[model samples]
Target: MKRVTGIGGIFIKARDTDALREWYSRHLGLDIADWGGVAFRWNDDNPGAVGTTVWSLFKADSAYFAPSDAPFMVNYRVADLHALLAALRDEGCNVIDRTDESEYGKFGWVVDPEGNKIELWQPPEGQ
Candidate 1:
């Protein structure tokens, strides 16, 4: 029997679709069509990474983040935390870099144009 593999896509609601699409394209370099959502490119050479590239977003006010008061839309695993943070800032994106050495990994946060919180993570060596 076949089995499920990985994630498919992330669908986000936006107050202003045009503005949101433009913002992602401008800031994150994500090519979004007039009505199409964002599509992230992954390394083709990596066999371990074969699936739809996306991260879903749920209501933070709900039981998503547990007892935390802050809202967490999604957490993304990025390659270069510093470089990505810098690029996001340079493109006028709201980025919060709170890099702390922990057992988990280095982490940071960014908010999209639609005010959804996005978490960027850099995994530790030999994880």
Candidate 2:
């Protein structure tokens, strides 16, 4: 099975979320949104193929990256969430049992050996 296709997003915990966001917006020209993130749209080599990679900031104490205690979490795009997650579980990876699905995509979690929480995302059709 093909594993990670690409990076879906990069999330960082911030002591001062607003300040950091503004700094990134003003200095780095990130175009941060009201939700404190930006979606960078791009195209694949395939004609008309488009996708988005997100960059977002979370509060310092947010439990979003829970179970690993990491300050950052990386979301990897996958072709098939259920299949890959099953394979990870079968391979003895620390795959989190919980999964979520929404308009955006299907989501799952896994923890790396170094205790960093990893998010697996399969974007909605045509994304």
Candidate 3:
């Protein structure tokens, strides 16, 4: 048997493609080049290092999330949790930033104009 390497890309449908592209570019600074897909670099380290994962966010009612109708979850690795949250808020985006050692590392979430939930996370130091 063989194992998978990593996620290739994430694709989603939009009523207004151009508008959504601009929204992501403005709010998240993601470069939606050809098909509104952003390439993000992941962290690979020693001892429980999560590889680069491409996560997509969709509406809770959308079929993309799951067959049972649940909110989409896309956890993105960010460099600075505070700065990212601040920048997102400055861009008029609703950012939820919370940190708890018991849980994961610093984490936050933001919704795009299309009502997609985008999660942001900052792993513990060296993780």
Candidate 4:
């Protein structure tokens, strides 16, 4: 099984999220939405296969990356969340116990050796 197919998103914690968002929007020409993020869409070489990469900024004190103490978190796309998570556990990786499911897809997390939280996402079929 593929461990990580691709990067799903990059999230950063900033002392001033609003300021950072404005900076990215003005300097990088990112169409940041009210939610303080942007989704970049691209077409794969394969016909009709479109993919997206999300970029977002969060408040410095946000608990989203909790227990990791890292200012940033990386979300990786996976083909099978449950299977990959099981493999990670079998490999002795520190897989977080919590899981979430929603209209978006299934979600899970694991902390790297350096204590950076990693997000794993399996997008809903045909997404």
Best by lDDT: 2
Model 1's C-alpha root-mean-square deviation from the true structure amounts to 13.0
Which pairs, if any, clash in model 4? none
| lDDT tens readout by residue for model 2, 1-127 | 8889999999999999999999999999999988879999987754567898999999999999999788899999999999999999999999999999999999999999999999999999887
Candidate closer to the true structure by TM-score (higher is better), 2 or 4:
2
Off by over 4 Å in 3: 1-71, 97-103
Q: In candidate 1, which residue pairs clash?
A: none
Ranking by TM-score: 2, 4, 1, 3
Candidate that scores best on TM-score: 2
Looking at model 4, residue 91 earns an lDDT score of: 98
Task: Write candidate 1's Cα lDDT for 1-127 as tens digits.
Answer: 1111222345454556567667777997886644466545554546654323553334334553332344434566666677778888888987764555577666677777776666666655433
lDDT for each residue of candidate 4 in 40-94, tens digit (9 for 90 to 100): 8876543566777899998899999988899999999888999999999999999
Candidate 1 or 3, higher TM-score?
1
TM-scores for every candidate against the unseen true structure: 0.45, 0.97, 0.45, 0.95
Question: Could you tell me the TM-score of candidate 3?
Answer: 0.45
Model 4 alpha-carbon drift over 4 Å, by segment: none
Measured by TM-score, how close is model 1 to the native structure?
0.45
